[model samples]
Target: MKFPNPHYPNLRYPNRRYWYVPILSALLLLLNGGVNLALMRPLTDVPASMDKLRFHLDDAVFSLFFLLAAAVFAGAFSVLRRERGYLYLSFFSLMASQQFFWEWDGKHLLFGDFPVLPAESLAVKSGMTFAAFLFFRYLQGTNRRLTDRIFIYSAGGVWAMSVISSISPLASPLLPFLSGALLAIVLAYLLLAAGRFAHRFRRYPEDSELRLIVNGFAVFAILILPDVGKDVLQVLTGQRLGYLPVFWEACLEDTFPWALMQLIFVFGLLFFRRYMRVLEQNREAHAEIRTQHESLKQEVAIRQHMDRLLDALSGSYRLKDLEHTLVAEGRRLFEPHSFHWIPYNRKARSIDNSIDNPGLDSGELRELEELLFAADHGLVPGEILPGSKFAPVFIGVMGREELYAAISPKGRPLLERERFALQLLAKYGALFLDYYAMMEKRISELERYHGEQPWVGKLFMQMAEKERKRLASDLHDEVLQELLAARRWLEGSGSADDPMPAPERMRLALDNAEFMIRETCAELMPSFLSEHGVIHAVLKLADKMRVRADFQLEVRTGTLAAKLDDDLSLTVYRIVQELLNNAWKHSGAARVGLDMDQEAGEIVIRYADDGKGMDAEAAGMSPDRFGLRGLNERVRLMGGSASIDTRPDEGFRAECRLPLKRTATAPA
Candidate 1:
């Protein structure tokens, strides 16, 4: 069975051209031939005695050259395992044989004067023959199994023959020929093996090439074997072997092997040409396929991203609930753990309060807001995380707006794809946000217009309630006190003895009138609000509440010497007064706390009660209890915001932030 080529279904390497391999091989062969010629020239003039030979540089130079050649071949075999292993192994074997010749030069130098030592002569001959056998096996592509064995066995035989032949002069003369004959047998094995394999597998191209190369090798061996055999037969017959003739024959010995080596070279050249053609075809197909695949992948990715953007935008609307929905959609689509919606205040050139997705730290939220404010109406994809970290994505605004979404754990700066998608998302988001502002502005204008409406009875009717509270304060401060004073005078005037005492009768009439006044005043505005500003009003109201209403009050105000507008001053004073009344009347509590402060250009009123604060949602629905609504409306009229912070049994806290601007002009 044939082994499959390991580099089968060959693909060309884009980085390296195929022609380099064959060109490199050709250069190496030329270098080998040049070195051989340079070395061979000096050997011709060498004396018979090695010691008598003139100093020539060829021996030392050639030894180093072959050592380098061995190293080169070893490296080359490793790189081109499929094509050059056999060739490189042959080159290494050749180097070893040539090196042996120089190392054992005593036989050549002694010649007939000392006589060629049978051992040395046989050893050198065995090396040459083994090297030739390895080369032939390499060319036939059958060196893997028998090459090392051939080298070892051939060397052993030479060693044994040298020992046996040295015992008799006749056998000593025959040693060289015996070594040559043995080497011929190794070559014959290669040639015959190649021929047998090829005959059985002629349809295989490699087999056919092996057959042709082996035939060339066998023919060379056949020519040299007879010449060598004849010389050995003469020694066995006791015939004299002449030195001059044998030395001369060595000069002619290289021709047959050299000619056969040329034939193997031709086969290598053809194989390389066929491989180059196959490699070229593979390269062209690979390039075309890779280009198509890349284009398709890019196209698909771009389309999918566009689709996601369109889907997000199409579902967006201007309602607050819809804004929330949009944020959720963005988080899901982008896979961000947190999302932000910040309104761009164009006039302020700033961003408003940000609504954030859950699980976000305060600093992260602040950072996102800052990035949104910095953007100039295009996808910023601004980086917020450290240069080395990935956690925040600061998506820029759309079209020079203050709106930006800082997506956390989605990482920043956003990738190019993410930037594009965010731009699309922001464009649609800006539209919805702008619409919400427009609707909110119109509603605000309507509310403000209605508050200033002259039709008092059709209005909130909170004025009637206000009038009642003012009356109650007047009764408590003036009429009720006077009536109590009169009663004290009557008691001091001995009212206990007389049923009709004048002072006592007058005090009773005064008390009835005072009682009637108190009842009527409770229907009007609280007098505390009219008597003082918001902070003073809240404090006085807290003082009026009984110990049954648990209460604590804290009030902070600005030192602004300028007086505020009548409408605004009245609004703040009434709202806090009404909230206090509700806390005292409804919340069955032991304590209530009222805190008022000015911060960030707004007055903040906070009212808290420890009493059973009603369910916020349920209380909000009560038409009878419109105090909270009234407070909200009052703050809105003053261009402020109000938030109720409360839960059942936990108590209630109302926080109001009102933008207070001092009136520049009073009516002259």
Candidate 2:
């Protein structure tokens, strides 16, 4: 019996191809770099009128463009790879891009070109503040609903701030202070995000990706801190500081720091792709393991169910009991909506519907009978009947007799293990039915003859007790006397020059004592009966009888004689021994014929002799005269019949039929 392996329908992992995303991002980055280089002027060719401060300002503008392009590429990679950290990185890049554009316009202001409007400056600052709030909120892992509410409230607040700063004359003076305050808030949020990432890295020390994120956040925060400090100083004093040189101020305050932050973010994004791939692989491996574990558990449960069903069925001895057990076990295993037994009536040549369940309608019952008749032996797969909601399975119990079951409409179809269990149930059911039929017939026969026969139990008990006393007396008188005489002879004075040696005399006495003991044991329970069964014991009995009596004995037996159980074999052997003894001692028979055979589930024994016969009527009236009454009682006790045929001057003939209780070796 092989069980099929369980399959998981939803465990399939798609083979998604993501190899081309990095290749496309790299090509776009190169093209953007080439265009920036083509637009920029040479630094060494600046005119003498242009001071070092102006020259550094032009160089800073070129670097800001490069930094902007890099930030865009990193944001694109984060989006394409679908990293969890992409939201924070994207919003922060937008905030930085707005700040850089404001600085480029400020550089034009330094040369007295006032093309930028005050309203436009306030609007860009408001946009930068909004992007910073969103970036901080997402970094803290806020829920979607709360994040959406924050976005709405912040957008309204920043819009109102921009409108007030543009329309009110007093608000224009406070705009620089407001911008500095916003930059300080953004710097504080960047540090908070870095601290959070650092705490996470400590919690999961094995995750190198978390450590890399913590380092990236810390680096970006440190680079932007100086610019925030410079803005704070300018807002407090209400005047630009002239302590640092122009070149250092342009490079350290904004351009150099922002470019380095963008570069670090781009490299981190590339490493994140590899880390996400590893995480996906781990998830797939864990899912496969869980699936296999579930499959193994199901297999063990199926094996246990089979063992439990077999144990229950093996103990059943009657047809009704077996049917009930099958139904109970089937219900537990299959959870069927309905279950029943359909018995075949051999005499009527049809199904016996009289004892069927009342729940079954006429149409369903008739369809079941038809299916049982049409189906072959063993398990028949389920099929839907004409008016049935569920398919019914027909399992043959014996010949045309079957067990019927219908699964529930919503239940799944039978699995391989369940079908195997049904097949096993059918086989055991058939065997139990056959054995039950034999026992039932034996019981009925006993009931018919029970009233006519004398009570054999008390009689047999009394005879057994008397036989034991006789055996004890024989051992004490014969064997004990021989051993005592031998012991006395060895102790007494020996005569010299005797014909027989003294040791020989003692050995002879011991041999006789041993033989007497063996003979007594044989009479109580023959060795051949226990060793070989009834047929061999009968042959040995005849051989011994031939040596003791003047009659010739002939014995014949069949193959089934070897298959009888120990109790039945012993009883049959005793019957044959008794009949042979009676014929030798009372009938004065010259020859005897003992025949044994099996037919119609019974053992038949026949005995005949050529000797003077007595009157049949006289022997029936006085059964104890030749121990004939005891013999008849023995046969009756075994649910059998015995008869003797005799007449004056004719041979005696007797026949007995005993019920056969077969052993494991018996044919099915």
Candidate 3:
């Protein structure tokens, strides 16, 4: 049975591409086999002469060929993507050293390229040799056997001794002894780091691929050992082993190691292929189950968003006075375990009634409230508790600045959908609360203005209505009559302009006078006010005056919204007009801003000036500035409030909040 190996994440499913590992291992075996064959060629040829020609040819050909093949194998191993950290590194080092041995021997000693190749070349060769040793040293950690460590240290010691022997003339005669000692030490260490470590490391749970690699290296080392030993024996004893030169003898001796290497490589292929086949079958069987799991999660998220949407719609209010109902309904829909509507009293350092979560202890509520207030911009419980087992999923601003907290009932972390639904609920709740609060303020202002100064309020309303009728009549009578007379005179004068009657042409003169009056009428008040209602009138005025202004004015209006009484509409228009007049005369502003938005049967008109404002005394002086005083009174009479915000040198802003229901009347 092929069990799942958590150690190999990518290999959880069978992959046909994995066949490359086996194929490459087989090729490496062929290279080693060829190397052995070449080494033995000289051994069989002659007696007493120790097969010198064959031996030399085999050494030259096999060493170069094996080195190149080893390099290719190492490259292939590096690409395996499985168990690569140490296994690939070991193969790379072994391949690199083989190349070094070939090049250094050929150029400096065998080919006699120079006395000792060059100082730089010699140093480079030494560095490569040391690098190979160091890789095996580090690789010891992946393979647990104590023998791997002994192998690394012993090989390192031999290389150090060889260096000492090479550089000193007094030690030059010890070259053979030094070379034999190093070779012997390496063979012994390889037997241990590879052999002993191979068996011990294989005990790691479920990592068969790693075990196969370890076993393969150990087998190779074991197979090559006798060959190396025979060579060392021949050199130390100054006697040929059999019909072979010392090097050639080593090659013949390697027959068993090379054959065993091939066997181990074949075993590795068979085992991995079998394991991969089983892995593929398991994946195919379970694929549908995994897909269903993912689909269910997605469905749950969709349902959550739908729930939030339904709650929002059900709680929305159509009347301005019912905004508080909208808020309450929204709260009920979200089913927040805890809920609080905190008032932002900027004067007090703390939020009021800020706790919104239900059933929490007082201390917990306070803690959650503090965290909510401390949040930057907005806060989500999950973000605050990050990885904590108990964190809230959603936080919201309830009033103008207070936050609403919701913790999931089951104590599970809040999913993304739940958090989003809560956030939407919170946002809508805040908006409705803001509207309700504004309504209350306007009501208070209306009561004060109507109660304390009833006559003043009434007079302000009469003046606004009179101003609208006066401006309308002026356009309809004086301006229209003059323009009509001018048109008729112009038509009758025609081409001659009564030149025959008089050189001054009395008819044409009358037309010019009428035309000027018509232009003046348009400049004073646009006709849309009486024709299309306040919204359209405001838009038309912005358009007509846009060209004359220094900066652009953006006029935006919401949908048809609730209709307002003529008196209320007149108040809005007059308030906007007064603000624009102030901006033009006192503000020195570059742009005029105006916006009208309606929600819950209420209309809000805002106007801002982007220029310097007057002194504080002038800003607050209602008695001195009758326009401001008059604008305030007109809004109050219509059950609304007018607020002027200005700072000296910055600019001035004015807003009029009006209740739509109180002003609902058929258009005049």
What C-alpha lDDT do the candidate models reach, one value each?
Answer: 0.54, 0.60, 0.54
When 1 and 2 are scored with lDDT, the better candidate is 2
Candidate 2: count of backbone clashes, pairs at least 3 residues apart or interchain: 0
The whole-model C-alpha lDDT of candidate 3 against the native structure comes to 0.54
Better of 1 and 3 by lDDT: 1
Tens digits of per-residue lDDT, candidate 3, 555-578, equal 677775566667667767777766
The order of the candidates by TM-score, greatest first, is 3, 2, 1
Clashing pairs in 3: 223-257, 337-358, 338-356, 338-357, 338-358, 339-356, 339-357, 340-356
Q: Judged by lDDT against the true structure, how good is candidate 1? A: 0.54
Better of 2 and 3 by lDDT: 2
Candidate 2 local Cα displacement, residue 256, angstroms: 97
Query: Tens digits of per-residue lDDT for model 2 on 322-397?
Result: 7787677766665544445556543444666665454567786666666545554444434223334434555444
Best by lDDT: 2
In order, what is each prediction's RMSD in angstroms?
Answer: 21.5, 23.3, 16.7
How much is the lDDT of residue 256 in candidate 2?
A: 35
User: Best by TM-score, which number?
Assistant: 3
